[model samples]
Target chain A: MSAFDWLPELLERFKADYVLIHEDAAVTTVGRARVLELDAEDWGRAAGVAAKFNLRWAGGWADQLTDQLGGDKLQINACLLHQGDVLLLRTRVPVTTPVLPSHTLHYPGADRMERHTQDMYGVVFSDHPDPRRWARHHAWGENEYPLRAEFPRMGTRGDMPARTDDNYRFLQAQGAGLYEIPVGPVHAGIIEPGHFRFTAVGEQVLNLEQRLGYVHKGIEKIAVGRDAVGAARLAGRVSGDSTVAFTWAACMAMEQAAGVEVPLRANYLRAIMAERERVANHLGDIGAICNDVGFAFAFYQFSRLREDWQRLSREVFGHRLLMDCVVPGGVARDIDAAAVAQLRAAFAPMKREMRELMPILYDNPSLEDRLITTGFLSESLARLLGATGYVGKASNCDLDARRDLAYSPYDRFKIKVHVFQDGDVLARMRVRADEILISLDLIDELLAGLPNGDVRAEWPMPAAGSEGLGIVEGWRGETLVYVRFAEDGKIARLFARDPSWFTWPALEQLIHGNIVPDFPVCNKSVNGSYSGHDL
Target chain B: MLRLFNKIRKIGVVTEPVMPGRDPAFEEIGEQLHARVGELFSGSLAIREVDAGSCNGCELEVHALNNPYYGIERFGVHFVASPRHADMLLVTGPVSKHMEAALKRTYDATPDPKLVLAMGDCGADGGEFGCSYASCGGVSKVIPVDGVVRGCPPTPLELMKAILALIEKRQGG
Candidate 1:
């Protein structure tokens, strides 16, 4: 039986009657996700049903409806996933009194998202557990909502005072033994900045509150008025490590919105790029995690391997990171038979080296001692936070978008989704290792059976007000994008929700019992994208 | 432990030479800087990196300098945790408004005789996320920069060369 087979019946049983809007249903169907429009009053009730059905709260974003219909209504979108199917729940609230019932009471994952929406669009989610400003910093005033239509893309300059971050009220732990350890908005390492306040007693963390809008580059605001291709470029930079994934997701959204079909060969190439990106990141991450645990040998070896892997990517795809490779309607570059042969030849040596190194890492007593049971995030906590990707997979929440959703060329490949119930640092490491091996095999298969045809298709402009959703299993996890085009063939509103949104909160949960020293290893194990989350 | 030794034996030496050959222009510039500044940095250069608002692309490339191939530490270059210990500030990203004050504070905290190297196009001049309501643009807007390395994300070799140039600048050359 399918996982979402009971979704229709469950929706019908909801107290609030929802009207399914199918105006752009064709575009929505491109992602194989169902879209439903409901009354604002029923939003919370519908969310409750989703939670009751054990659906994963994917992400939520707010889109201003001023361009489509010159009014004060703001369209709020929430995505829920059960097995393979994505159920997008949307509701509209007036701009004057932009208040809606919060879904955080049912699904705690919606807390940060609702706060983000509040910051960006001024849509208040009444009864949200933590109603703190999420994505907003001192850059924009409380009165100004950047994502709203009236707000200029460049924004009102110098309207607010500098350095307003000092006033943020971190949840304090008041006790004799309790003391707060504030770590960065500027960190020691060569990393993106995000402040972490750990309320700890005797080296055990009581509460960990994160302040992460330091890298917010106004991505959503800049995406507006950009053409489909321009938007894809913007999306590629949303998270640098997940460039191919973000670009692919953005392109997929744009193509779906414009009613364009990418060629089969292009789809296959995209998979190859995505897999390469995955391998590159996993190798780096595995090394970084080991480094955090004082395993320098593995760090050196894995970093070398990753460097060699990225060099091959540069040779084949032209960019070291494969940025701008996935464009609207198709890919920006294509590989020849020689390049294919090169990739196939390269994998065997890599696989052999990886196999040789795995035992050394797994068998190392000191490393295992550091990693094994450290940073334990219970399965219940992982589920509650709506964690996906390696973090979720480690906690036994087995959902892989590539295997479950199986979009295009991925449907042809037999993908293995690895799950470990340990919910610890070692489990996360094991997942990354297993994924690396699986991804290598998949890439080999993809290249071996690559279809021969044209790579690109001409994109036709769809009517204004058309919307499309693109979901891709990025290296980190599920990357969901929603795109709506304007009358001038520009993007009206584009929201790219990275998997870090779900996983970052999981980091805070996992670090509770562990000592302060273990925090780095635990953080590396999860490796949440700060820029991606901030955007 | 025996298996670990065997594995190490199989992998062999992966480290490469730091400077295989220097670019002619770089060599000339190096000499000019060396002549201009006489051993301002006699021993080692310590760096502190700040991400203003990058996509983390440039940071990744910067990190590659520590890997086996580059081994920047061998060249008397190291990343320090505190700005006070740092001889250079390797700043990345288009400076975001939120990070503007933080970047300034970091720059101010760094001791004098500090060389500020803005890495990546975003650091030199706001690449994609330019001057806007949310961003103040490049590193120079928030803090004065001595050198700029250009690329969407400048390659590791490019970064090494830029670092070398900064080293010369620090030496009063």
Candidate 2:
């Protein structure tokens, strides 16, 4: 049976008083998902019911309600997934006493997100497992919540010394041979900064704790008053590698809120861009993962191919990473017949080269030794954490927004979602490799049947309080963007939830029992986006 | 291994010669640097990169430097793991407040005669996330930058020219 048919019956069975079962008319003119709003008191119970019904926790966020709206309160938003249908659950707490029951008790993946909401909006999640700050690292004063309407965009300049986060209390292990190995907020490589505290006995890691938010640049705060197009540009940079995905999602959200209809050609072009991005990232990652395992040959070959791929992207799209390419109502650029032919011609050779490299990676005993069974995450833990994308797919969670939650151009194509039962470094690598092949095929199909027409639409200003959600499958995984328009045609709030939110916490879980030296490859396998997480 | 060798033979050497023709201003600076330093800085420059708070777009271009296309190692410029062993520091992002102290510490660790190059528009002028509650503005706000490469993400060629300019400045001083 379809998810929509059985969801309401299941909710009724679990004693859920559904306040409203409304269509998502605010975002799309057609094909809106069923948005279920529930009572605040049954929030935690609803979470338990959903978990029991086998729904995955997609993501959660908080928005501060202004007093001008006649209520000084904080609205909490949580999303759950059962097959293709998305169920959005919201609850509110008074600004004076902003506290709600935590969902982490039912959905373990909600832990970090709850803490993040608590840190940014000062809404306390009572009975939260670990209450210590998640995203707030003394970037602002203890009492100052940055997401509040009263908080200024340009924060106060302080004379406080650097290294203010020296006193964060990490969970300690108490044994004779136990010691902690603290790594970066500043790493050795050309990567974003994040602190990892590994409590270990000798080389075997006993426990792993990550302290991110070192790269938080007030993205959500700066997006407060931007126009739909302007806010999309900001969203594009949420994670540079996932620029196309984030921008497309943001634009989709904005278009939905404004009730704009993107042309068929524009949707097709978006698919091509998104697929190219997927291939590029997968190539780079396959190479990087090999490099981490001390295999330089695969690294060099893959890097060369990735470089060629990006150069082609620059020639076709305006940017190498396709930054700021997707604007509200459509895309910024369109491909002609010649560009389409060039793209179609380039795929076969690239695939040939990739096929040539695959055997070496699969047969190399040393590489296999490093990757197989290393940093293994069981399927149970993966589901509990709601880890989507390749990380979840590697662990056998078969939910791809492209296939399961198909939308627009993607719905027209037959997508091959790759999933592997063994949740190891090897499994993740294989998933990426399979995805690269699949994305190449998708690109060929998309370009071969390129749609005709204008690429953009005239987007009318959305009414104030109009809200919409945009969901897309990024290279990393599923990306969700929620956009609400203000009265003056400015953005009320734009929350872009990257897939890294669910996967970063999984990195901590998988690192257990693995040796310290295996940390690099294990970490690279997941390759969580620090900027996406921080934002 | 035999298959790999055959594939390698078929591909041959794909590295292209340095064009040095994209930006005239950068080309002129490159010429000046070449005249000033000659082979002195060639084959000896070690760089350490720190991402203050960039979107990883700059980091992707930075990684491309080591690829076969740019092959920065041919010019003796290689990325080092530690700041202590480096002759220059490549900083990206619009220095976030939380990372202010860490960037300062990385700079201090890089030893004397260290050159810092701020990359991308964000590193130079805090691209989108400007001076805010969480950000302290560009790399210059947290540490002194000797040169700046301005692009949303400067192409690898632009980055190469910027490196050459830094070498010239060091030698001229």
Candidate 3:
């Protein structure tokens, strides 16, 4: 079904076009993710080939190769999703003339990822469309690259603060009755900061442009000296709401790098906590979306449910958001009988309230009037944008890491991924509602079959130059983490790709032709993470 | 409409008992933040929340303050959209350098005789992510802070306690 039989042979033929320096597809404990090296000249062509093979573009990042030799080389890496596996393409370029062909021409989602790599590592994409500064809003000087090994972690800043929000150009659309509405970096409500510039004719938006990186707290730069546990804590902070998944991803990367087999019980507990997180966020989002449409009752009810659910998480796992719950070797705490019983009993009331409210949510004609056709993201567009979570599901892009790339815990579980065709606000909300029930069921089954064994294994410090990648389905969408260890097993570099990276661009596309006021509910339905995206 | 009413009645009176009460787990929140910004926001406080650059953890708890369980609105604390209408600014950070001018503009916009209370450990002293090229490190570095409610993010109850504590300290209690 995959039709990847031609992959190996096709790769072999590429040796004639450009030099094939190195190639290996390592089957690590995590899974098989094929890695290959290509000459820097044909970097864009490789992306085209991957696109031709129908591989989903995962993410793109760069590693500054500070070899023992005097050669100053930077290795550019791009990951593509291939049926429960990943094909990583790496190409090397000298730091002086760090330019490669663009991948954005093939996949629209690669636009920001490539820009981020450029902003951080000073890698240049020659044919990049709309090449603006991303993640570099006066964070450093124009020539200074923070991700470079020589650059200070605190940045090259002095006593006074540099002006950060000026001198940037935004695209202009001139027409009759066209006016721009600028929102955020600092928003009206309790949310993270990111600037959105919109050009609209009266109420209908003509174009939407976003300038983010206001929250780029130097996550990658700061992770330089931290060990595995410390790295996990920092990863947890990458996105506050999806702390469990981020922490798990970081820890899983470390575990795989160290070649340690996590205890079966720990993996089970990890799945349970991840599901709980999914449920909590979904409940909060559904309520928020309803509230956005002026349905105050649903917001109040859902808030109560979420608050209650999170309190249990804080009680059982020692933090409301479940940060630091998943450690390098295993989970921080084990579930005692009382905690397990309480958790088992917690779902019934939640499910009952949800059952009563969902029909009301779907049946309301007034709410439906606003939701049924607003913010329609077509199926082909979702795939092009590499959208995931409810945003993708609503558009009938039925891809879920839990099912498609099934790992431990999820490997045994039967995952029901719901997809819809309308691609409107209503479809997105319905997907969230459906997914909450599915996650609840998953958590229920996991708790019922709680494994009895040691919850942790010894995680020895991995050798220098060890690297691994970890991925999990975060509440927002697919969360990917890449970590490389340095001397004394300290983190040399870490790149985290939040689902928001894909969904943010998708937001820009979906907002086209929608009224200005409907933006909030549509945005709530998608709920992209700002802190996660900024980092 | 009748069906909606029936559903509402069936799930009746779900508003949480006001205030963030003590939980079974975690240490009791006994620490009271000290601040003296004079007697302002006496019977009511209009808060303008500025995220200079937070992990959004503090914002989550701040939002929880409005939830039925910890309904601070019942106690006369409300979140205002515009800074000019607010009596206090609840800012969260490691204040990113990119946000400095915006935060300054927000602070300048707020009418005088206002209190600025930094939220979270990051706001208190930059937490784990200290001063960097990207970050100015701590909210006080960017704007004057009257008091702080500390935690990676303080719970909704803890935030409520801190807000009340700020009022008490300011009113010379």
lDDT of 3 by residue, A1-535 (tens): 5634656755765664464545453433223466777778788887777777678998889988677622698888888887767777777899989998989999999999899988899999999997898888875888999999889877666757768577789898887798999898788887888988999998899989988888888888888889998899899988888898899888888887888899999999999999999998898998899899999878888888889998999988888888778998899889899999989998888888789889888888889998998899999999998998889999999889999878788998999999999999999989989999998889989999999998989879897877888889988888899888888989987888899999998889899999999889878878998888888
Give lDDT tens digits, candidate 2, residues A1-535: 5557877576575565343323443422212555555556667777877888888888888887675754887888888777688777776778888877789999989998888888889988878888998888877877878998888877654645446588899997798988999999888788889999999999999899999998998898999999988899999999999999999998888887788889988999999999999999999999999999889888889999998999899999978889888888888878888999999999899989989889978988899899999999999999999888999999999889998878889989999988999999999999999999999999999998888999989879888877888999999999989887888889988889999998988999999999999999999999999999898
Against the reference, the lDDT scores of all candidates come to 0.86, 0.86, 0.84
Per-residue lDDT of A270 in model 2:
93
Question: Which residue window of length 10 is worst by lDDT in model 2 chain A?
Answer: A22-31
Clashes of each: 5, 0, 0
Better of 1 and 3 by lDDT: 1
Model 3 per-residue lDDT tens digits across residues B1-173: 67679977776664443233444211132222112222354456799999878988888888887877666675567899999999889999888888888999999999988888999988998887777767778998988988998898888877877776776666773
CA displacement after TM-score superposition, residue B110 of candidate 3 (Å): 0.9
Weakest 10 consecutive residues, lDDT, candidate 1 chain A? A19-28
For model 1, the superposed segments whose C-alpha errors exceed 4 Å read: A1-4, A15-30, A67-70, A159-161, B18-39, B169-173
Candidate with maximal DockQ: 2
Write down the lDDT that model 1 would get. Answer: 0.86
**Local lDDT at A488 for model 3:** 92
TM-score of each: 0.95, 0.95, 0.95
Scoring model 3 with DockQ, what do you get?
0.66
